[model samples]
Target: MTKRSPFLELDGVTVDFPIYSGGSRSLKKTLVSIGTGGRIKRGGGRISIQALKDVSIRLGHGDRLGLVGHNGAGKTTLLRTMSGVYEPTIGRVRASGRMATIFDFTLGLDFDATGYENITLQGMLLGLTRSGVAGLVDEIAAFTDLGGYLDMPIRTYSAGMLTRLAFAVATSTDPELLLMDEWIETGDADFFQRAEARLKTLIERAGILVLASHNLALIRHYCTSAAWLEHGQLKAIGPVEEVLAAAGLSVANAALAGRQSFSNAQ
Candidate 1:
């Protein structure tokens, strides 16, 4: 096969937010008047966070893309942009298949509700019909292993309980594209073992799986290709071994490291 073009394309993308040291939000009363039209429409009010910069990427079928970056290097922003959470301030994002993003410990979990109730709520958020959640309720609750606690309020559950429920529900449907950021942070070794097994199954089913994490071993073993992103741009992109070698990282057989790749970007 000659191989096909990417199912998704992002060319010359950029996202920027102003650093309102003064009162940009209150500037309406201080500077520009109402309906100026020509001036930038930041907001009706002020203070902002410049979360992302000029970032661009492309994804094709069978691409297990890994995103590596520092704490605020815009990994989450890029993932959100890819998933249509936040529209790009510039450039374009064209994707062929449906995209799903799994960020945060219990992103859509309702704390006031029972584990059972939250599963239904999360399924609804994932766009699953009532019958869909009802069908999977038993499965998700069983995997969570919270026993009868499934009937208790989510606020009573620990972070680990919430994580298990979230992962179980999200993976049950097998989305076309799966985007994740540090998804396994809430479990013990035994639970992680089970979660890892589930993740492997998920990767096998999805056409594209993109994950961003500081976990080196996870990236090397799970992802076939990795991209080092810094200052909102891709520094290096290639096979796990090649990119890690260029960054002077051993990544040992079972080791992880910090974002020591900025030197190579210069």
Candidate 2:
């Protein structure tokens, strides 16, 4: 059998979320009249918000694609669509590979459970078997450095500690297709430094990566290509530099501005 190449393709995909407004008919009518940020459609007396509209993209092995746009510009929605979290209202999404998503680190976490227990839970949620998660226990624990805290209920842990625990478990999976909502930056400075290195390694190992971030310099540094989304539509896409230019963003300027902000904070 021939080896299959990893690829992801979205064909005229549009995602609509139905809005259930339980109120008097007058209230529903008012909402429809006022409209919302997303495109609103009314049918069968139900209102729906179109989060993605006629968007199409194709990515193959070695593709590092960055998604750029303002908040609520369908960046996260597109990532979810690619991850099969959201079925398109129309059109198709076809992907071939082992996929992992880092959208929400705490997605499958249980605050009432111990760190070790949550590790098993989250790992299983990520498609690992019981034995598989057991095998990763030591490595995940070492990466988190939670130590005795792993035996204690996670609710007793601090926010940063929870982030450390969740992030460690989340990144344990080796994926051919990796989808991330934003660059994973959590925990204390020291942990962040280590996490950054680990994240870079993961990105390098992935056959295809789709990252949605507001940091233009980070995108330029990691991505070969870029896609610009606006109002739930693909506005532009091409080489990183070209797409950034089209989006009115300059990587150099963004980096300089970041430095200035840091210096001012100091």
Candidate 3:
């Protein structure tokens, strides 16, 4: 009995974002100048930044991939590309699983809406129907443990409360492909305990997890494989230890400190 191949594939994938001068950032100006298809040009004074360049990756079931790199290293861009938020400028990206991205917990949340209402709104943003989210209201509410605060507007909620509600709603459904920017480590000690448990459960249930984190120890402990991105390119992809070593990290020390393995790059 042999195993199946990966459901996700990226080949020569390139994503570009045009750099508009401050004056040309207005909607009217942007609309009139929507011509460049992700390439550099001189006459237009519009330059495109290649956030990802000829990058390739393959992810299979049970693959926990750790994305390692610096702040502008295209890790998040690659994750967004995989999540279908950004279309490739030069190549192709294909996947065959239900994907959920937790890039920013507060991204689609409504500050003026009550916690309960925002849950429905966020759920809808995840491609669920209003009725679909309504059905899970109790479960999500229970997970947040906000009690009466659920009726209050999100603007009234504290940072920890916001995080709790956001996390609960984000993980309400089980997604086959889970893409996370980093480990959730905010909130108080008690909340932290609960969040840790919930995160562990969610990760276990996910068939594939792509975690982009600066914490190398988490990567070494959780991910069987790693992908290192540097300046909008795939630097290395292989076993965790090997990739860390290639990035000039003292793997043993990094594992103990829970710090980033790419100290040189940082």
Candidate 4:
């Protein structure tokens, strides 16, 4: 049987951001950096960051794939590219669904707007219509329970309040594909418990999920399959158990070995 094409494809994607040493010269420095290494060394920086390089993946209808990598190993970059936040410089991407993403450094809130207003703005940005956003506004505000605070500007709210409101809105949106950089774990410990329960339900409702997380237990328990990312490419892609073992993260063998060693010592 032939396998279907993934809903999202990152075909040998590569992206880079330029680095410059001097900031004051502006357009004048452009000429200097192009002509000579000496000028560039003096005015432009010697190094640059390659955020993503020749990375590729395919996410399908049934894929609950976990992305594993060290920090700066392109995990977040891959998620951002897939989410349309960062376009690939050297590759083609084909996407075929409405997406909901949560990697918000600050939950992408606007300070000038009320929690109620910001939810509508962000929801529309996520592809919802006026009524679609309106219908959810009440639900979001009620769930967050900011109460009269919902009428106040977001700037006046606490960080935890902002996160709660942001998460409430983002989670309430029903998207075909869900992209999570890190699972939502914000606010006080009490709020965290509620967020986790919501997360479990949200994961079940989505058609496909591409998660990048350092929490292995959550990855293993939730993902139907797994992909191990190292550097800028996939190291292993298969059934959750097999790929995890190939990544040297399986705990069964380690536990058995420890038991044997302990017995021998006794």
Best by TM-score: 2
What lDDT would candidate 3 get against the real structure? 0.84
Q: Tell me the lDDT of candidate 1.
A: 0.73
lDDT of 2 by residue, 165-251 (tens): 999988998999999988776748999998998899999999999998877777888999999999899999999999988887775
TM-scores for every predicted model: 0.82, 0.86, 0.85, 0.80
Q: Give the winner by lDDT: 2 or 3.
A: 2
Q: lDDT of each structure?
A: 0.73, 0.88, 0.84, 0.75
- Alpha carbon lDDT at 116, candidate 3: 94
Tens-place lDDT per residue, model 4, 1-266, is 56444388878898775665575347666665565534534424445567777877777777788876555667888888888878887897778776778777354578999878888888876678989998888788778878999889999998789888888877887666788876666759888888887887888877788887666776787898888777767788878888878878668644553443344222
| TM-score of candidate 3 to 2 decimals | 0.85
Q: What TM-score number comes out for model 1?
A: 0.82
Model 1 lDDT-worst window of ten:
257-266
Sort the candidates on TM-score, descending order.
2, 3, 1, 4
Instruction: Select the stronger candidate by lDDT from 1 and 2.
Output: 2
Query: What does the lDDT read for residue 89 in candidate 2?
Result: 92
- Candidates ranked by lDDT: 2, 3, 4, 1
Best by lDDT: 2
Can you list the residue pairs that collide in candidate 1?
25-45, 25-46
Off by more than 4 A, model 4: 1-6, 23-25, 32-48, 105-107, 250-266
